[model samples]
Target: MNKVSLLSSSVRQQSLQAVALLVFLVMGLSGAMGPTLIPAIRVVFGLGLSSAMTVQWIPLVVSGLSSLILAQLLHRFGAKAMVLGGLGLMTVGCLQVRLAILAPFGLDARYGLMLLALAVIALGTSVIQVAANLLVVQLGHARTASARLTLAQSFNSLGVLVGVSLGTTFALGAKTTTAPTMALGIGQAFGWSGAINAAVLAAAAMVAAGAWGVSRTSQAGQAPIRAALGSGWALAGAGGIALYVGAEGSIGSILIPFLHQKSVLNLTLEQAGHYLGWFYWGGALAGRLAGTWLLHRGAPAKWLGMAALGAVIASALAALGSGPVAGYAALTIGLFNAIMFPVIFSITVERSAAPSAAVSGLLSTAIAGGAILSALVGWTGEHFGFAVCFLVPMLAYGLIALFAGFGALLPSVDKAPQDSRMTSSVGNLSERT
Candidate 1:
C-alpha cells in the first residue's frame, strides 16, 4: 500500500475502534440499569426481592444463548450490519421496556411483558458484544488485542458508573409511596436508554457509510463455532468468562441492598446507591484504567491470576465480616474485578488454535454465567441470607483464579512449538530447553 492509502486505512481503522468502544460503553450503561433499578422495578410491579432479580438473570440467559449464534450471524451479515442492527434492536427494546412498565396490566402480565422486553434488549446486547470484539480483532492481530480490549473496557466501566447514577437518581429517586411518580421515573430512564441507542445507531451508520471497507467484507470459508468447539483454550476460556462475568455481575446486582443492611453501612437506599456507583462501580472504572496501563507492560496471566485472588479474598471478607469492614470488602471486589474479562478474552484469543472470531463467539455464550450464577446468588440470598449469597461469587472468583493459573502454565506465542495443535502443558514442557 502507498503512504496515502496506508494513512487512509489507519484513519478509518481508528474510527471503527472508536465506534466499537462507544458500543461497549452504551451496552454497559443499558445493562447496569436492570440491576441498579431493581428497587424501582419492585415498587412499580409490586415484586419481592427474588422476583425483581429476575430482571437481570433471565435476560442475561437470552443474551448468552443468542450469542451462541453470533459467529454464524456475523458470517451472514458482517460487522457493520450487525452493529447497526443491534443498536436498532436495543433502541426498540428500550422503548418496549418503557411501554411495558407503563402498561395497566395485572401483576403477572406486566412482569411477563417486561421480561420479554428485557430479552429483546439482551439479544441486541449480545450482537453488539460479538461484533465489537470481532472488530477489534480485525483491526489488529488477536495476539496483541488484550491491551486494546482492556482499554475499551475502561469505557464500559465508565458507562456503568453513569448508569448507576442515572438509575438511582431517576428511577429509584421517586418516592416509593407514590406509584405514579415511581412509574414515571422508570419511564424516563428507559426513554434515555432508547434515545441513546438511537443516537448511537445513527452515528455508527454514518461512520460506516463514510469510512472504510473493513466491515463490508464477509467472514468466509471458516465456521467459527466449529473451530471454537474443537479448541481447548476456547473451552477453558469459556468457563473463565462465564464465571468472571457472573461473579462481577453478582456483586454489582446485590451491592445496594448489601450496603443498606444495618449490620453493614446502616445507610439509606440513596446513600447505598452512591456507594454502589462510586465505590463499587467507580473502583471498577479505576481498576480498568490501571489494568490498561499494566497490560501494556506484560504478564497479563500473572495479573489476571492476582486480580482473581484479590476478588476471592474480598468476597470472603464480604461474606464473613460485618460493619464497615464488610462494606469496604464488598466494594473492593470491583477493583479486583476490573481486568478479569478483557485479560481472559485476550489470552484466549491469543492462545487458541481456533479462529479468533470463533473463540470470541464461543466465549460470548459463557455470559450465561451471569444468568445462572445470578439466579443462584439471589436464591442463596433468599434462603441462606446475604452471607451465603456473597459466597456464591466467592466460589466463582476462585475458579477464575485457577483458570488464570492454568493459562499461565501454557506456552505463550513466542515459546510454543511450530505444531500449534500440541497445547498440553506436558507436551509443551517436554519440548522446552
Candidate 2:
C-alpha cells in the first residue's frame, strides 16, 4: 500500500483523518458543555439572562483569543503533540470546573473560577479544531473538502446530542439556585465529562504515537498568520465564520426560553431541554449527513447560498409565527446551519492564496462573534422578547448568503490535495462510515 508521509512516518492518510475525527467527537462530547449547561448555570447561580449568557460568552472569547495564537503554537510544536496536549488540557479544565462547581467557596468566587476553568477548555478545543480541520483538509481531494469536513462535523453533532441529553437529565426540574442536590448533579456532570475526555486523551496518544514524526512539521503544515493575512478572501471568509457562529449561538443560548413561550411550544424548561437536544441539534446532524451528498455532487457555492437563504427564511418565520409553525421554524435553523461552517471554511481555503493553518486560524478567531453577537441577541431578547430576537440571526443569515455570492466569484487557490490518492478517497470513506 502507498503511504503519505505525515511528518516523517509512512502511514495511511486515513489514520490521520481518523485521529482528527475521534478528537472532534470527544471535543463535542465534553468540551462543548457551556451552551448545553446554560439552564443549569442559571438555575444554580440565580442569574438573569445577561449574566447567564456569560457561561457561553466567556468560552467564546477565550477560544477566539487562543485561535489567534494556535497557528504559531502549531508551528512551534507540531500537530501530533498539539493533538495530545489539546485533549489533555480539555480533561484538566473539565475536572477543574467540576471542582469549582462542588467547592464550598462563596458564590461570586466559585462563579469566577468556573468562568476561568471554561476558558481553559476553550483554549484546548481551539487547538483540536485547528489540528483536526488541517488534517482532514490536507489529506483529501480538493473538490470534496467541504463534504469531507461536513461528514466529520456530523460526528461532532452526534456527540453534542448525547452531551445535551445528559445535561438535560441532570438539570431537569431544579427550582432553587442554592440547592446542594442541584449543584452536585451539575458538578457530577462535569466529572463524568472529564472522565470521558481523559479516556479520549489516552486513545489520542496511542493513535498519535504512530506519527511522532510530526516533530518536524512540513512547511505546508505550518500555515503562517502573515500568509493568511495577505488574502482578502480569507479575511472575508473569516467574517462569515464569525457571523455564522454568532448567529448559531444566539438561537442556542436562548432556546430554553424561546421554546417555553406560549407563542411557540409552551413547553416547560425540562421539555424544552429535551426538544432542544433532539430537534435543534439533531436537525443539524441530519442535515449534515444528507448534505454530504448534496455538497459532494452539487456545487459548494450554490449549496452555501441555499443553506444561508434557508436560515434567513426560518429565522424570519420563527420570529413572526406562533405555535408549531414558530417552533419548527426555529428547529429548522439547525438544519440550515449544517453546511454553513464546513462549506464556508472549504471555500475560503480553496480561494485564498494562504496555507490552511493561516486561513483556518483567522476563520476560527472569528468565532469570537459568538460572544459579541450572542450578547447582542441576549440584550434584544431581554427587551424585545426571544421570538423577536430571531431577527438578529435573520440578518446574520442574510449577510452570509451575500458572502457566499461574493466567494463564488473568486478563483480557487492554495488548494491542498496531499496525494493523488490510491483509490477513491474522502467520498468513499464517508460512505463506509
Query: How many residue pairs clash in all the candidates, one count each?
Result: 0, 0
Each prediction's TM-score against the native?
0.92, 0.91
Residue 120 of model 2 has an lDDT of 87
Model 2 vs truth, CA RMSD: 4.0
Task: Tell me the alpha-carbon RMSD of every candidate.
Answer: 5.8, 4.0
- For 276-380, candidate 2 gives per-residue lDDT tens digits of 878988988898899888887888888899999999999999999889999889988989999898899889988887777788788888888778888988888
lDDT of 2 at 18: 66
Candidate 1 per-residue lDDT over residues 111-175, each given as its tens digit? 78888888888888898888787555445433456777787888889888887887788766655
Each prediction's Cα lDDT score? 0.78, 0.78
Regions of candidate 1 where Cα sits further than 4 Å from its true position:
141-143, 213-218, 412-433
lDDT of 1: 0.78
